[model samples]
Target chain A: MARPFVPTRMEEPITANHREARPSGAVDTRVEGVVANWFPRFLANGLDYLDVTRILDAIENWDQWGTTWEAAGENYEKLGRDALAAGHSETAGSHLRRAALTYQFAQFVMTGDTEARRRIHLRMADTYRTAAPLLQPPATPVRVPWRGIDLVGYLRTLSDDSPLVVLIPGLESTKEQFSTFEPFLLERGLSTLSFEGPGQGETWYEHGFRDEAYVDAMRALFAWIVDRPDLSGRRVALLGTSFGGYLALKSAPGLPVEAVVDIAGFFDLKDFDNLQPVIRDNFAHFMKIEPAEIEDVVSQVDLLGTLPLDVPVLAVHGEVDPIVPVEHAHRIAAAQMNATVWLYPDGTHSCNNLHTIVRPAISDWLADRLAVGA
Target chain B: MARPFVPTRMEEPITANHREARPSGAVDTRVEGVVANWFPRFLANGLDYLDVTRILDAIENWDQWGTTWEAAGENYEKLGRDALAAGHSETAGSHLRRAALTYQFAQFVMTGDTEARRRIHLRMADTYRTAAPLLQPPATPVRVPWRGIDLVGYLRTLSDDSPLVVLIPGLESTKEQFSTFEPFLLERGLSTLSFEGPGQGETWYEHGFRDEAYVDAMRALFAWIVDRPDLSGRRVALLGTSFGGYLALKSAPGLPVEAVVDIAGFFDLKDFDNLQPVIRDNFAHFMKIEPAEIEDVVSQVDLLGTLPLDVPVLAVHGEVDPIVPVEHAHRIAAAQMNATVWLYPDGTHSCNNLHTIVRPAISDWLADRLAVGA
Candidate 1:
């Protein structure tokens, strides 16, 4: 572990209502809708090329998007229910999973109205729950208590002897998107538990958004996993993507975790003011506050006292990441001597553009830390 | 079956010395190297992202390319051989296959010198031969006897009762690149036989190049597959890419095959004169003929008399394909009744840009025809 390096103030002035003043070309329309979602959509499609192609075929532009996904979700939902009626459990499970993913994507970028987002997210969660029992080894639902409410999650068992990895979704991501990523961990002898802690999916409805709520949720999750009869492993790892990366880092300090993966996460909140409006709007909406109050809460978010995580940390960031600055990775590495920071020269935010490289490396890193296949 | 549709002459004149005359930005330097070879390189890297990234990181431009791959091949070759010496057969097999692929890519686009091509091709073949026996289920090398010579190939078995599919490589492609594509076929419970016929790999060293040689080679391959006690498929399907697409269509008539998959292949030689110089020169070099003789021989290559294939056909092509026009797909479908032509509106050559759509559809179509998964 290295000495804690206090972060410096912002180099540029933080503009008020920064979203409107930001350059239009920063996050191009194509990048916002299609390109940014390719890997995630591929995951939702169960890595099936035909299904992905079919999705792409329906929507030619952003204007014709929402209904296509809704229709697709309905189609798959009908197919799944019909298959279940026909006693084709395997086929029903696959179709229902597809339906859940389709519903999730429909609400992926949807914000502004809580009622619509809640309706769509509830459908996504419900469909996933229906399909979970038929999944190989099955994903059992778990509710970890936080204050008076409960945080929703799913524990996907690989084996009792396998290491457990808690999957934390980003601001826009939900537990439903873990269908593809969960397999990588499972194949490497890791049990995956995906859940929305705060400011994500259904959890956003109850807990709203607070950075500390995520840390509290992780603590509760760890406690629950330790007590489960089917689950083993003294220490668990937190695998977080995007904003979830920040949560993983926040929870890493004093948390009983063997490893922490912060993929395109933030080291400091100094860059929060400079983020795109789409991102800023979503964060503010999740926080259950007006856009103006975002800066005050975000400013309180920093890794000032958090350092020397001691546990192995893996930070992957794209050098040209438009969403999260690459400097965050550098700062994380500088403050933590045991951190392995991989900065891709041509990668975008989350290095989703470089999925082929990032995905496998993360899996292998976690497997090594967990001593999988040993 | 629909009546044969004779193709009309080109509406525009073919350009002479087309390489220099073509638009400057058409095939950009980096795109010319990378985009054209993504699939092959993806295969060479064993479909591993880290391996591919390592190869990409080593090179700044195309000029300093060949030696890097040669060194990489040598490195893997040494590692594989050492593992073999230590009786780590599985590890050795995987590395040797990687070495063979690296060697193949080293000579992938090298066209000027036959000697260099032969040297690299030999190394690729030798390494693969050593690794083949160690592959899961093993790829048995079969020498299909041709006129006064032999065509080297590998028969990758899935099951004795499974239908066999013939993998015909494109002009620049060879059997070495089938490492990834073969799995798609095998997973569908189909056996794959990837071979180098005339104008491809070692076959070009011995028999030179002729369109008819491919048909002859397929005939020999079918005979061999039938005679093998371990192989029990009544019929075989021809799945070809690029020039192999053309060959698949050419051999579809009177060939004892269950189906044909012509991906981005052309129907007539009328468009040959209008092709890019890199393509024309490669064809001339393979044919061992003057560039002027290319058009004459190519002009004779048309599907006028050969049509109404009594088998299922899947023709996948990009609508805006630069190399082979999309109209070729339409013409092929018009001439053949039992044809499923998929034209991707925004796809590039061979529809590689639309691989997610094209690859799965072809496999599913072939599987449906062979009744493999039924």
Candidate 2:
């Protein structure tokens, strides 16, 4: 019998728009805009911290920017500084999280870092132990596949008429976390599907699917999606986050998908193996299994040796994403012949959260590609 | 006691240029240059084979101003077709490699795949074993390191007044492999030192310095370099190739070196880990060690974490390098604060042999930055 699924506290949803009380000061519009724009460009630039800082600095000093946003942005900068000084990255990341979220809601709304922005906002609420009343939870849930097994997924749909877009969450992520983009996509007349593949969410415990099965499960899902009547056989578009980027690319050659997007995805699995500690830490649950078995399975699914796909590919990555470093995107881009790469200078993996900008752009892209076909 | 170094037959000097005997009738100069320029860019653009073929068709039929370079560019179309049909990448890569190298030598070279262009040229001597006569032999003979060390290095003086520079060879490379650049740097009034670190030459057999020890050895070397009085406290610069790119960036932080130049270097170590079989096969000489020892010593010298250097950095990487991939350069650039990135869309890691293009650029860069008192 498989183990029972028990979601971690981090998986719980906090209230939306639970704006933290301002610390007795006017919001800085400039900082807000800077923070808002930071994530997309950062990711787009392949996650370069220097570029992120430069953009952040530029936005913080924008003319007529708000004070509150500036304060929040300053706080984030301080957090980063503190994290570096104290070697407490998680804490520092929290500060960036708050700054990104506040910037999203502030007067100088940022469009990028939508995921990070959302996460920051949610994390802020968690820190305060209060849920925002404005935040709405996901509407419907979907099923994600792993090997031959399936796990339930919670989805927030966007537009039915638009192209059927599937979002593959990163390691340890669930569909619930996709609330960051689901509604925003829906609001823009685009349909979005977010799922947790093998070794993630309920799949690991319920079905015992390991990370080695990720590509196969993703392939099966692609096969299933293309055959769906509701999707109307529309060209399937995939947006893979973090490690999912690698999974998406790996499965692309075998799937009949139209367009593929990798956000901070790893292209070469061998590269991941060299850094044993990182793999052990990130996939600790899966690593407890037999090494030889895992190696055999991983070898069969290695993406680097896989041939180029016959579809269009779009890679969205952060220049400064500490995890899932931007180089992975570069490798994917290099290997494929039909790939479009957008690097955000300040973005981190699965961190883009400001909805005001990314939502519209992503919607526009989907509309131009999927809506027209539909 | 250390076993004497036994150089490979490929290392021996050639009597004559092999290609000279082959009729130029088969060669399409125009197509060669065009394909060379276009292929690397296509790789850099991350296009799939379909897109690449489509783009090639467009370029061939497009009635733009019919320049000789463009006319010659059609050769790539045939090359691409041949590559696809060849099935094995080595066959395809050879054709592309030829075009890229030839294109670099072209007077009116297209500006694309800068790194690929260089890499093709640098690796040309090795890849096209018959073309050895066109290249010069190493100035110095391969020497074993002290104490049966896995690697051996020597700091040969090019000039007393010149700036100090360290040369790091590529995978399966030796200090002698840098014959092209060593003399070029010396001619440009720069002092260059070459070393066969870790997996390349003597180190693999003598010191048993594997992948994990790469950064540590580099750090130790930098520490030793800084204390040398013969160099007159001159600012040190690093020139790395292929795997050396990773070492360059990994060692950048916490070192007294002033600048680092990466030629087809890797940005992330984790990505390489996934290709354990390939890595082990190609770098077997470097990895014949106990894993426990590697784990114990790597933490103190790992480079993925926050780097502490504020030095200037220059990255010259091939956009289409099949071995190292260009994303590595992107990652390094993203992480470093003061970095100048030069992308040769068509160049490969062996940027030195791209008709000495990189040699001059690097020489100029070193002259500008490493010159005493500006």
Candidate 3:
């Protein structure tokens, strides 16, 4: 999402202890604006409106945004811990799970200081892992070796024979954000594998986002899925949002994917110089490289080179998506041998504004493609 | 509940066919204000924030509130029906269940015309029953004969031996609103019986709220549970909110209830003249009685005469509750032989504002009392 008008990346992440030397009004206004627009996205993605409302209300100081959210997350974490002490496993699981996602958002786009962001990200992962076993369908942590590091995933199955839906989070999103969407597929008897590729969530500290490395990670991941006796025979679908959508298509050509649901995916990459500075800066932050290197990375993230994927694909996009243009969806559908585009005319990024209808519809579409029930 | 507000009851409920003669601006503003305050309650009781936001945003005409919500409910119902036709049972069940609650809220305070409110209420009941069998641990629609009519409740059990928690809704709430709270108990090896006594939901039009009838309904409900061989020997907890809390305490004395949770229960009924007209009118509307009779009705709905019960009681209230004061919790606790006052200093009516913590905590407290797992 290349949206404009708020939260420019700073040279250093604002820590709990000090105020960054930036103009407070400008930073606060922009951040508040971003927060205002993301209400629909946050609610659709599983952040309780109450939680979102309270945290946003409490974080009047934009410099302390991360640490403020971190404190609120710790409150939930303590509540979860108390529930666990009382032997209320489900309550513990739900609260701790909420804490994980809270911590995830606490660090989201705080790329001003990657070190601080990574530390918070690691805590999110730990909280998630702690909640994993207590979930209704317990999560199975997945680790595939890549670039001398592990590409991380959390798999949750509904039943032994359930089909698989591999979910990929967006540029700033992580595996934890799939908590809301996972239910739509899970309720349809489809298991889910929510993963973090290179330069995402867990491994971002060590492994940077590289075009070739992303493809390699997917390659390794697919192979690992095949090797698992439990997941071998099941049909599979790939679903990714934003940047993940671009990568899903970029990687699907040579992979064993049966279907793909790409939300706001990219068909052609914009020139780094022509793109918004905020976009370029975020890319640089995510890539762990300089802004100039972003051009090379974008050059490799295009779908043109990997044309004509035979797998069924559903391109879901928002016509008014603040970031990627809706033209990308059209371009993507046009290039695919079998594809359809479901674009919401007045939707924001991810059609999150239309989530009430779109989420179930996409899960239903995936269920149809995989012949899940039948 | 007794706060000052805008909405004054109309002589007739607004109909889809024609607009009633009402001041649009005043009506709309007041209704909007009420909606503004109900966010935590709505989310806490299972309304998706997106749905609530969209519906509230769309309803500029306060006169059309019922019809507008009714239309939204139908849309979800159609979606649920389509999912069912496509064999997505779980998705269908969830959507339909949502539709039921949507329809329930559609008529929550639309007491302008008892006939119209009853019609929408029936639709909610039908939709809920349709979705019930598709639900996990499928809800059993219970009908016990009373006053020459069948009393209503929906029972869902985790297992053959799971302890039962009987959930009673607030003054304007129905059995369907229990959808959100049921999960806490269900997730903790407890069964739930969501009931609508004499003047609650489906039967409100037929049997008015008489103090004797209210007590008799609980007696009949407890007896019906005893007769079920499937639920034999299981522990039972009674939980009621707002007016339901008053009813629960007012009726628990001679019943076979092992535990009771009274959230925002009234310690003493204020004089009808002293109560806010909105609250008085709403109570009158719910009771289907003349406002003049409210004083006599309030006289009979107190816990003073029936106290000193040996059952474990939890009086959960807010220190600054808008309706029943925190003193209610203290008074209830004082009257009961074994009781605890969980008074949140800043909680709203029914402690709905603190639901995320209060709801699970109450369920966990009940679990501990019932010896649910050991």
Candidate 4:
């Protein structure tokens, strides 16, 4: 680790690395800051507990957050490259995936510069792309032509005849972090297409958060599914989480998918102002506007425009969710023509803390729904 | 999962399995009991976060604790057997090892019948033995003849020319839980022999806790090492944990060893009275004595008799250890002629809570100490 890092990676650098940005003042990194909120995320996700403990030990300040994570990621990237060179593809895939996961968390919740967060995030995407082909039953990076640009996705299918679960990313979350979710799909003998829509993941560089871009991305997703002979015949289900859940419902009208599952979706932006300062700031960063100006933007977001979805819909919400109220799930379920509401009594946002139970249940519910048409 | 009791395992049951024992009435599980002390141990070790959460959700009462764990262990045992039947040796080994760990925790602490606890303990050893031969590089179960019966040890070596580290188990911990600790030794090209001494693991049936049996087992270990040409003349270290630490120190005088590592070891049994009721009860079970009568045993145990050992010794203790006070480490270090004490400020019992930092520190310390004589 004393040796300077020369990352063996995918995609040449487009921006200067986040490593140069150092905290300028005496850092007060209360180690307990990471204990409560972030521990469950790291635990539920694939990050090794020991590695997280080690990585989080040095990160007491937001200024060093992404940088510390990037260093750890780079180490794994080097290990992956060396393992791959030695013809250990299995080992390489695992290591590179770990590297990608580190980078995913690096960009997750940044209270620092927005541009630096994107730089760290790009490394996540690149590391994951490097791992994609090496993963067992290899995933393919596909670009679908959308609104004069290509939206990125990773297509992983167990069988041609299996139903396809189109997974949409939420704010600050990309397809790379969906690795844990993919196993349930794979276990059920279902195909998975984890897509990065506009304002999410790689697509953010081309198009930031905008209503038109989001609507077009969903249209392009279904269009691409129809175009592919292998993917076209399979029953389709669109499963979205958090912000993406709202987007899924917004674009649900007349979509070719047979089923839709909205996980912790917002029914309206009335609760946006109620979000924590850190989260509000994160939201502002995506919109590139002041927090005060968000009321105007809030007025523009409402699901009633796309209500009473024709297809079978499932709304999954955590009753104890501090961010989004459980009533949102009830309201959404009440609106949709064929929607069912599931409220996990002890779940947090996205039910990530209850991932072991909620995830499999969601997969099972979706499988059952998709099976009806098949 | 719906299928009933049939275990594909190494041992034919001499005692009926603990699966039949059920709580008599309304079970007051109070899961928070597990949340405080057990979570860190589970997290630091190799258990999957999701599996633990799911498993803990079902275990609320100590009355059904061992029975619940045995059911989970049996599930994995079935999965392992099925995987092995399908010629998936690596997968089988991993699952079987998990099965072994579940059983390890099953018998860790019991508030009910000691015999039920013993029944569950037998499964842990048997399951681990079944997995030993399938592990990568393959671990072998070796029998070292003691006074009359035999002691079981899993010998996992990376190379022919390597120093061997004998890992001693604590009051309830057995060789089965040492899988997490073995990688560090393997990485350093050091051979590991995780041994279950008298009143530990499989050997408990033959010889329960007693001074003669404990001393003879340690003596027999070194004798066996000398007898085997492959093991003979190699540098060796006795690394004991908790009660095993006391035993390692107690047996250190006039032993054939180069180094000794005492992890959260006892200097004397003076602090035994202050231990938590559950732990004291567990220790009492091992001794087959009432808690109050343990004064006779406590008076007989002290490290002053074995003070100032000639061999290089490293005493690792947690400063904030709730079970064993940090004072004991200072006392032991003060007594030893050549001893170094490493007290982690934020570690719990056996430094199991600070395992991520303390474990590697230990492995590094032991490697450096052992290398000097090599």
Candidate 4 lDDT, A172-245, residue by residue in tens:
77888888778777665678898888778888778766665687788988888899998889888888988878
Q: Please provide TM-scores, in order, for all candidate models, with all chains considered together.
A: 0.71, 0.32, 0.91, 0.59
Interface RMSD of every candidate? Answer: 32.0, 29.9, 24.0, 17.5
Query: Among these predicted structures, which one has the highest DockQ?
Result: 3
Q: Across all candidates, what is each one's fraction of true contacts kept?
A: 0.02, 0.00, 0.14, 0.00
What TM-score, to 2 decimal places, does chain A of model 3 have? 0.90
Model 1 C-alpha lDDT per residue in residues A302-340, reported as the tens digit of each score: 876786587988888877777788888777777766677
- The residue pairs found clashing in candidate 3 are none
lDDT accuracy of residue B194 in candidate 3: 92
User: What order do you get sorting by lDDT, best first?
Assistant: 3, 4, 1, 2
Worst 10 residues of 1 chain B by lDDT: B7-16
The better-scoring model by TM-score among 1 and 4 is 1
Residue B193 displacement (Å), model 3: 0.8
Clashing pairs in 4: A29-A60, B29-B60, B29-B61
Q: Model 2: DockQ against the native? A: 0.01
Q: Candidate 3: misplaced stretches above 4 Å? A: A1-27, A271-277, B1-29
Identify the runs in model 4 with alpha carbons over 4 angstroms from their true place.
A1-41, A44-106, A109-374, B1-37, B289-293, B372-374
> On a 0 to 100 scale, what is the lDDT of residue B315 in model 1?
82
Off by over 4 Å in 2: A1-138, A144-148, A158-160, A208-212, A223-228, A273-279, A286-301, A305-307, A350-363, A372-374, B1-374
Question: Cα deviation in Å at residue A280, candidate 2?
Answer: 3.3
Cα RMSD over interface residues, candidate 4: 17.5
The C-alpha local distance difference test score for the whole of candidate 2 amounts to: 0.49
